[model samples]
Target: MSPLLAADEPSNLPDLEILRAEVGSAWSAYQDTKYTRATRLIPGILADAQRAVRSYEGDAQLQAKALLAMAYQGAAMVLTKIGEADLAWMAADRGLGAAQESGDRVVTGSLFRSVAHCLLSNGRLTAARDLVTDSAGYLEDGLPDASPTYVSVYGTLFLVGAVAAARLDDRATVRAFLAEADAAAQRLGQDANHMWTAFGPTNAAIHRISAAMELGDVQVAADQGPRVDSSTLPLERRVRHTLEVARAYSAQNRTDEALALVLDAEELAPEQVRYHFISRHLVTAWVRQQKGKPSHQLAGVAQRLRIVG
Candidate 1:
């Protein structure tokens, strides 16, 4: 068992609200790119959530299970970010179990998305695509008058599926998945972070940029990636999209532009840039290609990323 899954006996059990707030805080830490803080908080949150599950019963028990699911999902995301793919899979699987027990369709769907993410991280592109599609289909049938949370998770699933399809170079499937996500965004009518999904039209557009990048349409990604104002999205989303745009620029040999974007992202979220594979990869390549000595800015960013002295 992962240390993250290990539970400690609490002297006093925290109520559902407390657990929810802790989970929310951990998520906020993650979005703010404070990965270390997020990881530190998660184990305790998981332990407390487990205690809640053991102590509560009836509806309270179900709610506790939901919190556990969210906690585990957060763990998975953090683990994935830190390049712990195996542990992430374990966390995601545990979250799925908890989500099922919670009997919350939205939570279940969200966990399904997390599981697909784990698959994607592990290079199981086909499995990830199939899982997202199947989960989206299952959720769609049950959501007659869907809540915002339901719509967000349902749509986000297709967005993830689009990414998986893009990686497979399946243009048709990618377009179909994006269209489904866009339709869901239109139904929701605005950008909302329901259940922490951050799903909306802007997010759909961001996914299109991602798909373009995955499909090796560097020009399209470079053109469209920068124009979309992702300011309305979460900090994490904004930083990630910025990195993607930087990648597009790099692919086009727009080294200066790419370096500038990388710098900008680093300023916004230093931890994210330091830990992100794209930023590290780009910096490493720049350092390797330098003639005698790299530029001041390049050296500075490279040093910060620990890729140079």
Candidate 2:
């Protein structure tokens, strides 16, 4: 944990604003790409914080802590989404540490929420539940009334809880969590619109469709999935949506249709080899195996998908 204050004394809030601006710039560079150049910006971000900590111009303690807390949360998310569990856990631990030092209830609540989410991604349901439960007081204490970040924290709580329940096969609990997530998603609406591709209606729709599928509500998935407007989706995200539809087709036992769509997705974005399309191939391969035609083209696709994974 780093110091929140500097040797110099604060004279005005303008310097605080500049620090915030610098932080945004750093984050933007980090988001545009993750290659070597993008990775190189991290030191500048940390150094900027160090400079702010030493520059006496505002509520340095709160400012420094807040910036660190945000950084930790953002880094954790990047780690989680790309299937990098080790780095995500480390970043989350750092976030928790920073939040504790900063003593910002909202930030603390957000940190715990993030930790709970990473646990959910790793399929550690019990751990996720405990952390979110522990975080409730901080969430309620801060009363995430008008803050978009606060609303997002609760959204993650509900969504991750639903995922946990799904893992445990707790249909009733899963339904409950989905309800809560839908409510939270509604609360997040336009208030929490960030340029990042992480949260928003698209995410909420994915969850809604996935939940509907697990619940054996295919019509719901069909109806809800189409509402995710392509106009609102970025190219990479649009590819994800295609995969979801393919999954929906599989759940409906439409193997041929699923294969056609999966082929289209693979064609549209070949770099997405690590995603769930491998499982799709395995499923179709099994279908062929059952049909006593393991040598078929469908079976070949399954083998290729496994190799891709």
Please give the distance, in angstroms, between residue 129's alpha carbon in candidate 1 and its true position after superposition: 0.3
Task: Tell me the tens digit of each residue's lDDT in model 1 across 72-159.
Answer: 9998988888889999999999999999999998899999999999999999999999998789888978667999889999999998
The TM-scores, one per candidate, come to 0.96, 0.68
Which candidate achieves the best lDDT against the true structure? Answer: 1
Residue-level lDDT for 50 in candidate 1: 85
Give the runs in model 1 whose Cα sits over 4 Å from its true position: 1-11
The reply for model 2, stretches above 4 Å from the true place, is: 1-40, 43-58, 188-191, 194-202, 213-223, 230-240, 253-309
> Candidate 1's error at 287, in angstroms?
1.4
Sliding window of 10 residues with minimal summed lDDT for model 1? 1-10
**Tens-place lDDT digits, model 2, residues 1-309:** 232433443453226566566556544543432323323544455455555544533457666866766666666755564567777787788878877877676677667767886897787877786565556545755544546666666555666566566656667777776676567667777423342324555666666676666566777776677677644544445566666777777667676776676667666654443334334553554565464555364555566565422
Q: How many collisions between residues are there in candidate 2?
A: 1
Error of 1 at 259 (Å): 0.3
